[model samples]
Target: MSFKVAIIGRPNVGKSTLFNRLAGRKLALVDDTPGVTRDRRSHAAKLYDLHFEVIDTAGFEDAAPSTLQGRMRAQTEIAIQEADLIFFMVDAKAGLLPDDTTFAGIVRKSGKPVVLIANKAEARGAQGGMLEAWELGLGEPVPFSAEHGVGLPDLRDAVVEALGADRVFGEEDEDDGEIAASDVLIGEDIADPDAEEVPAYDENKPMRIAVVGRPNAGKSTMINALIGEERLLTGPEAGITRDSISVDWQWRGRPMKLFDTAGMRRKSRVQEKLERMSVQDGLHAVRFAEIVIIVLDATIPFEKQDLQIADLIIREGRAPVIAFNKWDLIDHPQAVLAELREKTERLLPQVRGIQAVPVSAETGRGLDKLMEAVVRTHRVWNSRVSTGKLNRWLETILAHHPPPAVAGRRLKIKYLTQAKTRPPGFVVSCSRPDAVPQSYVRYLTNSLREAFDMPGVPIRMALRTSDNPFAGRAKKRT
Candidate 1:
């Protein structure tokens, strides 16, 4: 098992900045505002030769448990409990405070080994504060600058001495040449350029599905239901989740990674810079995921923002499945479901046959149907057709409704072939690629979807003029 290290500190003390440095990438959201990180996020990290898992947690506060800040502190406490080692960070420039001393006592009571990191030591006035950090009684403070790469080697030595180099490097020499899930690049569903056809997805790899919706739409609650744990902080508060948290689990023996993202609201309403960053982070998760589950409040389903979110999913070429959440709250289930289905078709014609499952995350009603729909949608998203079959279908489509005349010259579609899958894309060779009306393209797209039974996933078709070998030579002679 990998060793776990958690960074705990008061808000805006550069805990997230240190985490991003250790992870070798910016995994956590960092800002000047206090309490920006409300969830404890963990990622695989390496420090020179030492490899371990590092967790970045919410800043500790002294609010009541009923309040949001208190809940955030509760999460931090949980992180302290789970960590095999802790990096109790203090702002070197701001000097030691009473909260640092208090939290140091809490970490001391936990009985875990700790490394004191006096961050921002590069600042001109940080020397006195770094000296004061010793009063916390954790250990000797390592003057560190998380932003400027100062004292990293000393910090690494401290970690090695505390955890033991053997503990840090255990099992690393066992060479299997296997790639970890973290090492796999994002957008793994895209086609391999060297392969003749879009290859089948490796079942061993975890499927990444991002759950997104407006604020208080039960995304985190639904994820908790699916994973059977309250791993995320949840309550009556809107936007309790501020980061895109990814949880790994197995469903009926299939490995899956579920990303619980911060709720996204309208652009006009998102005036705060922190909320804007949260929304952008959620959008990034959608791009990285192969499938997106858009949760909607069943009571007031298909709001304007909900439609915009769905359209965004389709535009991203991700397999989309609608979860009509809070189903148990509905007074008339049958009628509401019927009306919602009608609205889905009318509002989302791009994904003509999108699957919408009514589920109550609170009660676990219809969870199985939701997963079933997800699996079906994923299969369709990766669907592929042979060139011959696509050309034959194209012929039938053209016979039914040929391309419209452009300037009294008839357009001819020469051939059709699928370029890739994972939200299937096709290339059409035609006489006049630019003259193909978008309406006609829509007709062919709909027809293709109906014929191939590909519903809910975006289908991309590119028009290209067929190559003429002698056209340039003839023009030169003339």
Candidate 2:
């Protein structure tokens, strides 16, 4: 089992920054504003050679029950209770406040190993604050700068000692040996698509899928129904989910990692600091996911925001499966389904023939079909076509609809070859590539989609003028 560490402190203590530092990327949103984080976010973190699950929690606050801050505080308590070790952080620049001392006592009461961290230690003025941190009774505070990376080694050593060297680094695991700093994997390492070829779907690697929609769109309920348990908190309230929570499960024996994100509202509507952070976090999930399921409420399908979200997914190059939730609540299912399909075709012409599955996330209806669509779209998104087959297909299409003349000369189309596929990027070599009209490019894109059976996934095509080796030399000589 991997070690679990929770970073707990008051608002603006740089806990999120430290969490990002340990994770080796900016997974958490960092801002100068206090109380920016509301819910607990966890990721598989690597600190040097140590691999552990690190959780970034909301700032600790003393608030009355039934308040929003109270709920946030409860979430932080859950993280603290579940963690094996706690990094009780405090702002060295701000010094020890009464809230820090109060929370430190709470952390001590949990009986988990505690490592006091004095962040912002890079400032010369913070020395007095670091000295004052000893009174918390946790232990000698590890003076460190989460922003400047001044004392990461000391912090890592402190964590190792707190969790024990053997526990942090398994003794008998031969393959999981200590890795060099250069060998550390960042968050983008798993996200960066393979360059030239579409990666085969591996059963071992869990397919990351994010389910997102507007508020009260039944996103969490849908996830609960799929997992066959109420693993997420759901109610009649809008904007319930504040964090992008990931749940790991097996779908038809295939490993899957599902992310349930906060409801996304219009930019103008997102005025609060906390909600803005939540939306940003949700967007991050979409970028990281391989397939994005845009959940829509069947009664009010294809709203302006729904279309906008779909557009965002296509622009991000993630395979999208449009799902209509609350189908059970809709009247005249046949007509509604027909209209939804027509609207999808008209509004989202960019991803023609996109998969639109109607399901009742509440009653668990049409779930199998949704999963099937997800798998199929994911396969197509990673599809690649050989150069010979692509060129052959291009020849047939070109014969049917020849390129239009531009500036008194017909564009000479030579060859077409697929350069890569995550979204199936292609390169077309021809004469006067710049003269090719966008309408012709669109026709080729549509034809390629139809010919290859690649629907709902983005396809990239680039026009390149064929090179003449001796043209530059001849020009120079002349």
Candidate 3:
């Protein structure tokens, strides 16, 4: 129930200072150099019991027409457009510059309310620079010194006024300016390493699932059946869904967010701006998603683009469940299901052992099974396997099928350990990492998948040469 606010201004205008002040932490590095921050940084914060998310962005400064800065400016504009509120800061001590006037015009066009802050107010008086700020046409400025911790209350009051009274943030406590509510999550996710306690995420927690696929693959139809409401705008047009929308629902009473993506077409074919934006927006949904359910048109399943998209999910370390949509279209042959399974196995070998369910988004066929696939794959994504058990499995794998002969020498894989697990990435120390063929790497990966019962999960194995397997060996032969 928290809202998001962004601190934006021209470079070196104490925007980062204001961010660090409101955040109550030194998350953003303060430096005299302008444009130090190149990317958008988001953090949770509290301003007088009004708990919310805040974004510290790269300060905008005019560049040589169209350069990297210009592209980054586009990203900044997008962030400003997305945020609920903005803190348009200007250095009162330095006075308004020409670029500031230019930026003021840009902010005015955003159509979102802005809180203009005359920063560096403690340097002298707000008289001179505050007068200069009047020409920007936003409104009267809230002069404050971020470094000196001044004028924060006026900033807080401005936010409450903009958000209104029927609010999630009731009021600030009379004592320490913290929210009096039990539900609010306080402080940024970042904290001091020595005394900080992080909020742990529950993997058992119901995650947002997205069903992304090509046109008429039953995205709208599937959601309609899942929620028992024809909520999505579905039509016969190839790319009718120009927006990726989310719906809240539950699986066995557990909360979930489901995103239905538009039909992705070839880059050469996407003519309209809406289509291009829809594709980009759909990709964003994929990145935010915990488990991405890739709905496929079963008639032409595992097309090059579908495979590429599925690979992209695995590459991003996201758990994916392939849903063969329009399953009802295919008539049942004597071994049609078996044939489909084989096709999936061969075409998308990268996501080996992953579930590929057959379902019709139109008729809600196999949705129960689809949810089961989603839950299972999600569990596998957040899964962590013990190093000892993994090493033992690796031992068995190496014993059964030793590495291929290279230069008339059989390479011995000395040890294997699960270094990290998001998709269960493993590091195997061997005689020669480069000499190990892709087929052999595939062999070990396939073996690990079967041994761990890790169906619907991507397995990653990397080969590296160990300097010494017997580093501390002594003469103990008996």
RMSD of each: 2.7, 5.3, 11.8
TM-score of each: 0.94, 0.79, 0.58
On the 0 to 100 scale, the lDDT of residue 466 in model 2 is 75
The Cα local distance difference test for each model comes to 0.87, 0.85, 0.74
lDDT tens per residue, model 1, 386-476:
7777777888888888999999999999988777777888888899898999999999899999999999889998899977887767445
RMSD value for candidate 3: 11.8
Candidate that would win on TM-score: 1
For residue 453, give model 3's deviation from the true position in Å. Answer: 1.0
lDDT of 2 by residue, 363-436 (tens): 89999999999998988877777677778898998899999999899898899877666577888888988889
lDDT of 3 by residue, 303-349 (tens): 87787778877776678888888877888833767887898788877
**Pick by lDDT: which candidate is best?**
1
Q: Cα miss at 403, model 3 (Å)? A: 1.3
Rank list by TM-score: 1, 2, 3
Q: Give the poorly placed runs of model 3, Cα more than 4 Å off.
A: 1-203, 333-335, 467-478
- Candidate 2 deviant stretches above 4 angstroms: 46-50, 62-70, 90-109, 118-145, 148-161, 172-205, 215-249, 259-263, 268-284, 360-364, 406-409, 469-478
Model 2, 446: alpha-carbon shift in Å?
Answer: 2.1
